[model samples]
Target: MSSETKSPTPSAGLKSNLPSTTTFITGHNAEGKAIVLDSRPATWKSFENGVMGFNQIYTNPFPPDLNGDADLHFHDDKIASGNLGLAVKNGTVCRMVDFGPGYVCMMHRTQSLDFGIVVEGKIDLVLDDGSSTHMKRGDIAVQRATMHSWRNPSTTDWARMLFVLQDARPLFVDGVRFGEDYGRGTEGLPRSGNDD
Candidate 1:
């Protein structure tokens, strides 16, 4: 169990079976034309253990940099936040995640409202209050910055889910604002970067 372990890199012929693709569009040259920025296949970063799901297929560094009026308006792939999710303050993120059989993410919470859709297979959404719901394909879930976790109960099948995370105001209770809690080091289990 070494923290120095490296994650799996995608090869030339290795394509993920997940059906997720992102099409980026941006403004063009002085002619004021609309152009396609990058229309390549979606990239997947496999987990080091090969059992965890993939995270952050694409990221827009600045969510507020929507207009091309800023000094830098493009995405930067080199910025790594260590947390696999691409959520940013006052911005939005689009990501596709997959969970293999018997995989259960630890309970965690972020300051974002997540809109998730079960694209393939089935998964159980467990809440902080111990309430759990079984979600299947075509099911849409709206998570409102609440503590939760995902569990894939299937023994032989994988579950693919698409999520759109939008930065939101921090949850306030009793006049105290609590920030995000990733809740690492649970159950003596190792931390997985794909927890989102």
Candidate 2:
């Protein structure tokens, strides 16, 4: 038996992994009846020669209903995840990311805490402190509003990760608040696309 994991290839015109089948479940009426609100294949957005794939799962509005056992919210599909915009105040965003071989994202920061899990292949989590760690399938990463990047060094493999981001206080340094900096410290890297 071979120990190599299979690398993903794009499906026809799709420049990313096979679309994810997402089913959104929610509660209905005052009785909290469970129901499937929507179920569809996730639409992928490609970046940097199809080296990266982005598919948003959902976005919760501000002040998530704490009083209700079942929360009814709307997701705005028009906004792209690459826009570097945070979710609504006290809100959260869920997404899936795919990294192709030789893929490396710019070192950037977001104003939200992120929980990520690797679903396939392996990747390197590069941090702003000149450090990195290799992550493989089933590994979970809890990023607390830190400056970081994703690197896929393999030349014949791809990596996929799912992330949940929640709004958080900006990183404060010496009494200065440093919020999301998408292109910060990304010199010498591809500027257009491949950012999240």
Candidate 3:
């Protein structure tokens, strides 16, 4: 990653008001005993004019190969390359997102099954049909290739969400395939599965 894009410690980000996130990665030692491979605050990337930020926790190709800790190497490569997009083809990505106060994300969709959990504050999940649902801490939203947007209703506090996105077959609704849609919110970022 370029120095400009490299993330500083969690306390140095645009969303400093939000609490930092610590990630724990486990692996097996040479003796085959489980060990703590890594435990530290996650790296974050602030975007959308600093109104939104993403902390990429981990990623691995589907049917991950853990032997020799190859998956860990893969994740390190992704970070070093600084091309971890919204989704990985035939893989899974665990990320944490911070929404600035009163921020509303653009409507978009990805070809993945996402499990989004509200970790702090409240948010509204708005669907393409104009329907929405209010969610608070501890609430989880199971998104199956749906066109949606997220809105943080708070005007003074930031909201945090942890999402696990797993690649899925392209959604076919009425014979129409809905591929990855970055929409307006994601401009510089590549589309899903295009990190390379």
Instruction: Give the number of the best model, judged by TM-score.
Output: 3
Error of 3 at 38 (Å): 1.3
CA lDDT scores, all candidates in order: 0.63, 0.66, 0.83
Query: 112-162 in candidate 1: lDDT tens per residue?
Result: 788889989998999989899999999989988788898888988878888
Model 2 — TM-score against the truth? 0.74
| Over 4 Å off, model 1 | 1-33, 61-63, 67-74, 77-86, 185-196
**lDDT per residue, candidate 2, 15-87, as tens digits?**
5443455535444544676554445456665666667866767666555653443233345432433343434
How many backbone overlaps does candidate 2 show? Answer: 0
Candidates 2 and 3 compared: the better one by lDDT is: 3
Q: Give the 10-residue window scoring lowest on summed lDDT in candidate 1.
A: 187-196
Candidate 1, residue 74: how far the Cα is off, in Å: 4.6
Query: Evaluated with lDDT, which candidate comes out highest?
Result: 3
